[model samples]
Target: MPPPSDGTRHLAPAKVNLTLHVTGRRADGRHDLDSLVAFADLGDVLHVSPGDALTIDGPFANGVPVDDRNLIRRALAAAGTTRAVDLDKRLPHPAGLGGGSSDAAAALRAVGADLGLDALMALGADLPVCLAAAPSRMRGAGERVDPVALPRLHAVLVNPGVAVPTGAVFAALEGHGPPMPDVLPAGDPLDWLGGMRNDLQAPATGVASVIADVLAALTAAGARLSRMSGSGATCFGLFPDPAAAEAAARRLDYPGWWARACTLNPSAP
Candidate 1:
């Protein structure tokens, strides 16, 4: 059955890579990565209506071209829907927040009921887990997922007002980069994440080293763990408590960088 109203609203959360180890580059131009993925209690809002066309709107709608290249459009097109897709912007773009991925997931499961997580999995990696809206380990070309128990973590996300293109960052590696860890540490998630790593950090740092500076600054601010997500620019620091995390965020002096303090989401069902 078609959706009752013009559309159904859904919340799409930004993602934090608790651990991202880019262990190796594969033969088919794909990067081999092992990442511990977690969702934030905070994210953008999406309203998907079954209709005749696609559209997007919000307060932060600048520069987000409503074109065929946009992930939401691609997702709706892939799902073979003509829905009027409206996305209220919240998460930073290309700052490694996984905004596009999350948006695509929303369009699929929330908007197009005919397609589910498994169906979208074949469309794009990260879509399935993103639809799940929980923390999971994504591995083997981003196909494998292990949904693990994660604690409610407090964190601050800092993004220098720069859009770091994922392709460019990966291309900058020139097919040469560090590899993902063969085995992650076994312990409490906080402890494990504290020791976790991001494989794309180096190339991302090379493209825009300010990300490295952000990591340093967050570490100086008493962050237990700090690392870049997805590709570049946007970095996160995990603290023990919400108060402590917000306190640290308030002290950051990156006037041009976008920052936010949000609690880490407990795993979703």
Candidate 2:
């Protein structure tokens, strides 16, 4: 059955990369990466109505573009249909949280169109996994998304309100590092995660120094594992449980910083 005539609403969950490995650069000048991806309950909201317009409003709406340049618009174009889209922009822009790409994914899904793989990739490298909205292994500059059953995790996401362009971070990278093992070690997820790394962290830090500070704060607040997500200005702290993650987030009183506790793998049956 098709969705209601009025349209459908979808959640654009935050996409987090637990580990990111820059394998190498391609001849086309695009970098190849291998990343373990998971989604958080925290994110923006998109509502699609039977019309051909887009309206964006919410706390972080001002930070995003509303025109064709906006990823949502591009996604709608890719889906080959026009719908009245109301985006409740909650996530910070360019925080390394994949907010825009996730929103675009949600929009494309809500349109109920069959935009093939090639079309989706043209929107953004991260759009494919965001469309899956599940724990997955992302490879080949984000074309391959293989679903994995990841344990639910309690995490606190922190962004220092700095926008680090993806291009600049890649430019700052010294060189490609060793890729992670094909299959992560079988053990406690947190332990396995600690042994991995976001290769872009150092270069990203050079672009946004506050990323290091965010990691330190998460650690001081008792996070078991704290690290930058993707080519970040945003980082995450993994906790033992939800209560602990919430408490840690509440204790963070940094001015001009955004922090929130949310659960990973929160999809409903």
Candidate 3:
């Protein structure tokens, strides 16, 4: 893909986990999470214009620091696209969903600026999935992602206006958990995933009890499968259609809470 046009760019949306399980711990003390990662129909939007600086704006902006730790900054540094990169935050950070990673993936791909997906997978496992930006399988500490045809699934993402610290959740984990499945079925991967699970939810829930509450809400709303995404406070529930997910999100409404209807984009939905 080529770089973005002179003034604008766009990012695909993001979603929380419908199920999160921490099956084990790693030698590096990282938890092996077998999460059902999905994308939302709505997410933070980024506008990029090649310039000499970086800027960010929008709601949920108070705490997001502008520094080297900012993934956008790092991505630009890595991609050698030194120009004005403007990010408007639509997603909350550290909410169990990879909002920041998703944002970074969008930014990186927006202009084809950052290190490509291949180089980034070497940086972190989740980075690859973010690059793929589709509903697929993510396993093996995030280093592995394989595209599989997923069942058309709709969901609602809910975050009760709080950020769950991922590092802290991983720190609380007791083991490296479990290994990735050796092979997944070749068709309708979502059906196959009904048998798969996230290995990190228990430990993550221990650290952020809201995660449990969120899942409960999802379940109460008639979600077929509800789980916390990544290591988070954001929870999602899978449903049969957009109407179902939207209805569930409606009945579970909280004014200050972050919520949206999301359909698993089999390809970057």
- The better candidate by TM-score, 1 or 3, is 1
Better by lDDT, candidate 3 or 2:
2
Q: Write the per-residue lDDT of candidate 3 for residues 116-226, one digit (tens) a residue.
A: 656676555667777777765666577766665455578888888876676776666665545446565686554665676665677778876777888888888888777
Q: What RMSD, rounded to one decimal, does every model reach?
A: 3.9, 2.6, 3.3
TM-score of 3: 0.84
| Candidate 3 accuracy as lDDT | 0.69
Tens-place lDDT per residue, model 1, 53-129, is 55666755676768887777777777777677678888767668778778777776675445655566666677766
Worst 10 residues of 3 by lDDT: 1-10
The parts of candidate 3 lying over 4 Å away from their true place are 1-7, 15-26, 31-36, 114-124, 180-192, 266-269
User: How far out, in Å, is residue 225 in model 3?
Assistant: 1.1
What does the lDDT read for residue 119 in candidate 1?
60
Candidate 2: regions farther than 4 A off = 1-7, 267-269
lDDT of 1 at 158: 88
Model 1 off-target regions past 4 Å?
Answer: 1-7, 112-123, 174-187, 267-269
- What is the Cα-based lDDT of residue 20 in candidate 1? 75
lDDT of each: 0.75, 0.87, 0.69
